[model samples]
Target: MSKPVTDRLLTALQAIQESQGAVSDTALKALSQARSEPLYRLEGLRSFYPVFREIAGAPHRLQICRDGPCRLKGQALAADLQVALDGRQDLDIEMVSCLGLCDCAPASALNETPGPLPDASTVIEWLDNAHWPIPVATNNLQRLPTDPYPGVDCRYGAIKAWRDRPAEDIIREIEAAGLQGLGGAAFPTARKWAFTRAASGEPRTVICNADESEPGTFKDRHLLENAPHLVIEGMLLGGVVIGASLGVIYLRHEYHQARRRIEEALATARGSGVLGPDARGPGLAFDIELFVSPGGYILGEETALLEALEDRRGEPRHKPPFPTTVGLHGGPTLINNVETLAAVTTILARGASWWRAQGRGEHAGLKYICVSGDIKTPQVLCLPWGSTVAEAIEGCGGLSDGRNLLAFSPGGASTPFLPPTAADTPMTFDDLRAAGSGLGTGALFVVGTGRSLADVLLAQAHFFRNESCGKCVPCRVGSAKGVEMAESALEHSPAPIEQALETLHHTLSRTSICGLGQVALLPLVDGLRRFPDEPSLKPLKGFTTGAD
Candidate 1:
């Protein structure tokens, strides 16, 4: 009936799932009686989240990524693996969405341990030997611009430097640096903190959204794994500015490496008096807790994340009593993503002028770009803001196998894919927006020649469709319908496809409750409008019925 019950519910369910392989009927009944909650509520959670199951699953589960970069690299990996291991009763192979490891194309997790997919023989060998390869934290912190302590031990200097100063001054410094939400929302970071601080509510909370679940976006994961101290310091700084004692990091469950790093960082901070009851001296209490999500892409949406914490189905809530004013447990909440919070620490540790000067041209500050798909070297690059998309491609060693660039999605899946001509566009919010796609999460998904634009575009649309929370009608039905129409267009031909998709996109954008619904069909809808002359799009327009 209260916060404690709600907070422990997901954890308890997870524990049950882990210990027994699933949440059984008798277990749910026992939990309902103990917590005094309705059985239907518990049932709703089990049905909504992908992590929970009604019955025991195979002991060893292999979930292979079938979205975006992974799909482009090896669309048949999961299927082929399934075919190879067909008779194994001890294991189950499932095709899943992104694993936040797009850099390692054709990513898969064996029994919740993530790694790049290997051949069936090697995997079987590992299973036989009782050894599985897992993702390890990459040691590239010194290369990133946002790491204030690059080569040295993190000292939490930012908090000590600004903890005693007026909160307004800290806000002014962040605003002067022109810091915006790096999670693709692009909301001004200073404005968010100020609003949350000014709002009248006790237990005002600060949250770092570590759930970067989109297919082409993994920069946040990199930050969480490599520069966790910066993230922790940033959230502590937020707690100081917002006058909040409690902070939560809503991390996606797939990031096993990141979870360990963050937990270690949190423990280190607490031991050093950087977080806890008297974190910044007496009367100023602040601490952060890491909350791993049960698993869902929609939970990346802020409101949907809140719903999960409240022990409800992870569905997006309607806005306009936004989280800044009415957040967790009816208190004002300040939520920023992993990269955004890390930038906060860097901006504060260094001066605002120093941060502003880090960018190229008129843009301000540094940006982390996740470059993948058809690139010679798939990786994350921390570049100055306003660096052109062409520069990003070059940094990733250009197109794979000397192939020419056909198109590129400047941001993640929700952003529209632009033609090769748009490569020179600067990697800023307004610049990318002007070039026909927004700088979404600073992710660049490049498509090389000889690849089917229709297939690539359809995959992006299907990602959204698969991740939709099904709370609202437009998103749930429209996303599915969009995928269906695109599939039919690719298989056969449809003349009204363009017009129908445009109408559907319009309806979803205007009527859908959250961003998940609003931008579900953006890739396909925009591709139809932008790439009329492309050979792959001809079938979608009913001009040709031949294969792409």
Candidate 2:
């Protein structure tokens, strides 16, 4: 028999959450005391997830998305709701930076359910009667392509593909396919598997990051909701190649729909004999469990995610001894984004030739592109490589109401923005960096004619500041200072920021521990670089200067 998911800290917390609507301090205390661990450890785990609470004061907690895409439409909507609900102590309103639902703006999480999607105005009904509508169907697996991960049947394909292939053969197949991480890093996937396979550790682990929290990114949610089986197959293959018997999919709590869908899929898969003990014949044991995060942008970082999974504060681990060698309870571990693994199933099944055929040039294979903000048709599209930003915009019905394109980020929020002049630039990784941004998660948040560029920058700064994990001085202090600068200069000249921003950007990039601080510098620096002639901030001529 497979180990019960509850034996793991993430699932144990899930158990508590399922039984009660919220995870309270009392529950964390009991679990920690029963496990003979320190209370702080449990507290650390309980605190980061926004869905869990320390002091239970309300029957329901509502978290709304204030991410860049959502800000295009939801910011004002949320503000109005806040005014309506003000002074109501029975409810708590939390603004979650990004809910990964750009297509459905003004999205919110009520208690543990994902919603208000098309019915965002329904909050009025909930506020009046404290009654939310039943959650929309999330387990619409029929929406998935019948054979999303080619070669293997979407249902029993993984079990058929594995048939107990040797670890070396499986590893070589992945290497030949030239698969790379679909997350921003784009690191080679096979190389990661090989390192973990060779590392010295008992009971190696595989972790899939389904926390699609990056602003403007939501393709993974579509996949998990439609074709979760494909992702599971990839994890099973990853386990076989790396000698891993344990797999965990750390999902985002706000994605209550995706969470429910994947959970149901896993149970169905186990029943079909594709998962759990006896999954790989008599002696071998391999199974997967699911975990949900409370809420934090920094939690998306792999090591910080591991820390949260182990019921600790989410902090990025220092480098040199990377996760492959010393990760997840000090055992060798393999970490991958959801899309990366989903792609793996297709590649190994159809072979490298099929993957190469899908590409038009050196930039091979299809990428899931999410186009939102000021567009006529906002949707997630899987396009082949070498496609241009202009093309993606065109596919999304070419700007809403034919508004002249203004500035846009080629990828997610962490990347630099490009003016209309660079609209023709290709979406390849190298082309984007050369153009001063990256093809981050292949998402384009096109800013339209009417939106204020300064306001967008300010919104970006607010997200980084609010999401900083407070682990390193560079991000902790730098992001806060950045918020001040952006807010100060939004309505006036941008000059007061020039000198301060230069040093601040350099300090953040050089001294920050992870990408949050480093990427946080982009909006300010890139905003100025893109529009150098924006109104100058009032000069600091009369002020006394401090030593550098």
Residue pairs with colliding backbones in model 2 are: 49-294, 50-294, 50-295, 493-536, 493-537, 494-536, 494-537, 495-536, 495-537
Worst 10 residues of 2 by lDDT: 539-548
Best by TM-score: 1
Tens-place lDDT digits, model 2, residues 355-409: 7667667766777788888888777777777789999999989988557887899
Per-residue accuracy of model 1 over 1-548 as CA lDDT, tens digit each: 12443357898898889888999999999989988989998888889999998988677888889999999998876678888999987788889999998988878888888778877887788778888765542434444567777553556988889999999999999999999999999999999999999999776888899989988899988888888889899999999998888889999988888898899989998888889888755877888878889999999999999998888899988888999999887889999999999999999999899999989978899999999999998899999999999999999899997799999998999999999889999999999999889998888999999999989999999899999999999999999998998888788655558989999999999999999889999889899889877887887777774534
- State the TM-score for model 2: 0.90
Model 1: runs farther than 4 Å from truth? 1-7, 134-143, 150-154, 493-495, 545-548
Q: Which 10-residue window of candidate 1 scores lowest in summed lDDT?
A: 134-143
How much is the lDDT of residue 309 in candidate 1? 85
For every model shown, what is its TM-score relative to the native structure? 0.97, 0.90
> How accurate locally is residue 247 in candidate 1, as Cα lDDT from 0 to 100?
89
lDDT (CA) for every model shown?
A: 0.88, 0.76
lDDT against true structure, model 2: 0.76
Please estimate how well model 1 matches the true structure, expressed as its whole-model Cα lDDT: 0.88
Best prediction by lDDT: 1
